[model samples]
Target: MKLYTLKTEIDAVPVADDFIAIEAPRPDCPDGGIVARVIYLSLDPYVGSRLRGRHMGEAPPKPMEGAIPGAIVGQVVKSRAAGVSEGDFVHAMEGGWQEFAAIPAGHFRKLDPKSAPLRAHIGVLGMPGLTAWAGITQLAKVMAGDVVLIDAAAGAVGGTAGQIARIKGASKAVGIAGGPEKCRLVTETYGFDACIDYKAEGWQAALKEALPEGASVFFENVSAEMAMTALSVSQTYVRGVLCGLADAYQSSGPAPHALNAGAIIGKRAQLRGLVVYDFYSRWDEYAAEAAAWIRDGKLAFAEDHADGLDQAPALFAKLMRGANVGKPIITVSEEQA
Candidate 1:
């Protein structure tokens, strides 16, 4: 099977042609496993951290080694596992970059494609959704009437968090996206009360204007500049939930703002960084609740799907450039006879 793995820590350039190939003997014990035909691969921001050995150590450089990072959902084409079988659509730790992935029986969750959008299992209902949920409910404990603001509001985490807050009974929801286009989306599609365009000059001022009373909760997705701006405008006792550093992901450096440490201390505000994996232990519980909300039409979500793993390299490049609208999932295969 062809696989992509990061082979170097080239911060400026990602060398894809350097991908090396190797053979794996067919597994001797296929009984407890499922050979999945990778359907959709999630090109998440967190994977960028794994490209380098220092930030996250998923694959160390060997120039001719792995060129693909894995985090995919697939359909079981062949399975010796009892509960799962051929034609079963599922989500797994294995990524869809490869044509085939043999996953342990226990790692796969059967996807009800009939009930929810098949692609959502890897997008909104997948890791990103979990990030939004855990970031809001678990960490910040967003409550009814809480003035909440989500940075990158039209993107994966922020968009969903803004909506979830309302479903959970927050009085107001504020969002921040790149421009007026997305700002409209935050208010219309995601049910946010207000949204700001960070790309617009004086965007921070817009944020302050939107929530003049000051945000009680900040669902932080992009940190540094946006974060400090939010902090400067935050109300006392606000809860800031940190998720990613997308604004500076492609750039190498310290956070832009040199805001005094007192901002947080004086406000007695809660700023906590979050990772989706930290709450994986509650996956089943979370998935069940989230799924029910979708069924009830309470939680709204969107997916940006790309066709083919071959499209992944370029697609991911788009993601890194912040061109994608929602969770970007590359569809590797469709139903076949």
Candidate 2:
């Protein structure tokens, strides 16, 4: 087996070779466990913070030890678990950055390749999609005629949330993204009503202009500055979902911009913090619904792919810097046998 391990403690955005490849014996299939051959590895922004011990309650991995953490879509090559059989395709968080993984029972979900693309199992039809579904449908309860806003609108969560808002009958879906290309993706590709490019001069003003009626629901994925900006133009009693703090993930200290309690209090906003793990129990429910949406062309998603296991570190580095256009994925092996 082959895997990548941490080469050093990550201080900021990891550069080249922060993860090193090494050879290891294949892990044995333990009692009530299955050994799977990894196919697609999911790379996410949160991994950067987790690697530095900055994420919520997750300890950093020792240098050159432990498999780097990630989610994977794979095929079971061996099984010791009941109800799970050899050759089953599954998705699990324990797969890590390795060619093969031993996943314990109850820690993995079976995937139907016919339901959607295998890669989609780790992207739009996977955890990112589940996150968006939980925040919009479960937390915010987006309703008809509501005006919704989202930041980081090109990536998986933000992109899917905006689309889900529209699907649920929101009158308008507005997005705030970094560049013209991503802004185009938000509006044209994801079907948002308008997209404001924050990198452009006067974008904050543009966001205000785009939302004349003010936002009724705000799905926040960037920084506190952006959150304040969105809140400034929000409707009274807006439902705000705090999904991710992409800007502050690399920092060793607290978030750079503090929350403005006054602004939130004045609006009487219903602010909810979204941690996706809390929604894991609903994965099957969400996947079934989202797969239908994808089959019907109602839900759209994007992915940025790297070719091999060795490319994981570079792709991860790109993700931490917010350079990835969509869900970042690594092709560890062929999806089909």
Candidate 3:
């Protein structure tokens, strides 16, 4: 099977092989073992961190663990289980970067694309959307009238997070993006109460004014600068969700500490690290709800399709550079519009 098997991380370079020969799944393996035909792929920043081996404390990925780093929607070519059958559209944890993948039944879930866009299985309707849901419901514990802040407002996770906050009850939802374009998208498109450009001068003050009442829930996507800024303007009993670190994902710089230790101590606020992996059990339920939200027009999602699997790596770089306004997705399908 062809896969991007990551051996190491080099700057501006991706370690991948188009056709790394490997054996197929065992003949005696479960009948549900199926041939996965790649469809849409999600290019995320976390994959870059995984390649750098930055998340060391977590369980490291073994060779048999799966593909290098990605999520994709695929069509089942062969299936043995009644739960899944040939022609079934499914999404997988490791996903098929190659043309085909022999995936076990358990790691894949059938999805109905007629209900939503097929590519959404890799974007808003997929893990990114679920990540936004679980992070807020499970981590933030959002309440009505609560002031919330989101970093990377135009991203797959943050964009959905901002929309979810507004729908749920947040009286004030502030989104922080890289520049004015995304800033406009945050407020005009995703419906945030305010949008701040982190690159702007006096951005900290802008954020403080945006959240005049102080942020109760800070959905942190960029850790270095934005994380610190959110903490500085956080409410006394604030909740900071450490969802992503776009700022410190690459370098080995000393991570910025959250605003003030005294505030967390004195105000009794909590800061929680959120790795969407931990909430696997709730994914199906989360996806169902999030998809419903989208169908109902409560949650709006935008995407940045970079086109083709070959362009996936470059799109990842673009995402890190904040060039994409939404989830950067690449498709294996030859049809490009």
Candidate 4:
């Protein structure tokens, strides 16, 4: 077995120095447990935050120096668990950046290969999808005829949030992304009502023009600049969900962005921050709805995939810098591809 374990605790984009790929003992399947051959590893921005050991009232980072901790999609090669068998595909938050993992049965969710691609289990139908769903359906509570605005609109969570807002009957679904290509994918490919390219000049004015009635709901990602922009254009009684703080994730000091209390007071807006893991109990419900939308062609997703486990470091760095267009995933095994 092989695992990409964290070897350094530095404040920087995780390079090869930060992670070491080494041979390790394969985990044994205990009673009520399954030993899985990991197939897909999710590359995300939050992984950087984990390496930096930033605790915002959340659990501490993995204590072991050579351990993996992130979402993964894998296949069971050995199973002592009831209702699970050899060759069963599964998803788990504990899969880590490893070739094999021994997981308790309760910690694994069986994935249907027939529903979608194996990589998608760690992507749109995985944690990122659930994150978006929780922000919109649970926190922001977007409603029909409402104007919804989302930042990082081309990324995994943002892309899904925009599409779900439209499907749920929001009057307008606006997306903000870095480049024109991603902007086009958000609107033209994912069916967002409009997507603003933040890299372009005068994008703020473009956002204002796109949402003439003001934003009723804001599914925020990225930094405080984008969050405050959403707040500035908010309608009376608007709702905002603070999802990610990408701007501050790599900084050595403090988070560079701050919330504008004046805007919240003036708009009489409701803003709530959420950690998706808190909604883990409702994953089955979200998966059911998301699968239906995907099956019916009402929802769409894209993947920016790297070929192997060794590619995880560079791939994760690409994702942090917003170089990848969609969900950044690593294909850890050839069988899963």
Can you list the residue pairs that collide in candidate 4?
A: none
> Which has the greatest TM-score?
2
- Tens digit of lDDT per residue, candidate 1, span 1-337? 5655444446642333434444433333256878877777888776554554434445543444443656677778788888886888878854435777777757677777776767777767788888899988999898888888888888878888887888777889988888787777778878888888888998777778888888889887776667777877778988988887775554445547344577789988888888777887787677778788888888777666778767777767777777777677787877442
lDDT of each: 0.73, 0.89, 0.73, 0.83
lDDT for each residue of candidate 4 in 17-40, tens digit (9 for 90 to 100): 567777789988878989989888
- The stretch of ten residues in a row with the least summed lDDT in candidate 1 is 20-29
Q: Which tens-of-lDDT digit does each residue in 1-337 have in candidate 3?
A: 3454434334332333311323444223246677667777777777656655565453334453345567878877778767777778888877644556667667777887667777877878777887888778888988788888999888888988988887888888899888998988888879998899988999888878887788889998877456667777888878988888776664445666445666467756788888787887787787777778878988887888766666765666676566788778788763221
Candidate 1 wrong stretches, greater than 4 Å: 5-9, 13-31, 54-56, 60-63, 80-82, 254-260, 335-337
Model 1, C-alpha of 76: deviation from truth (Å): 1.7
**CA RMSD of each candidate after superposition:** 2.9, 1.2, 3.7, 2.0
Superposed by TM-score, candidate 3 places the C-alpha of residue 80 at a distance from the truth, in angstroms, of 3.3
Candidate 4 Cα errors over 4 Å, as ranges: 55-65
Which residue pairs come into collision in candidate 1?
4-67, 4-68, 5-66, 5-67, 5-68, 145-171
Ranking by TM-score: 2, 4, 1, 3
Candidate 4 residue 303 Cα shift, in angstroms, is 0.4
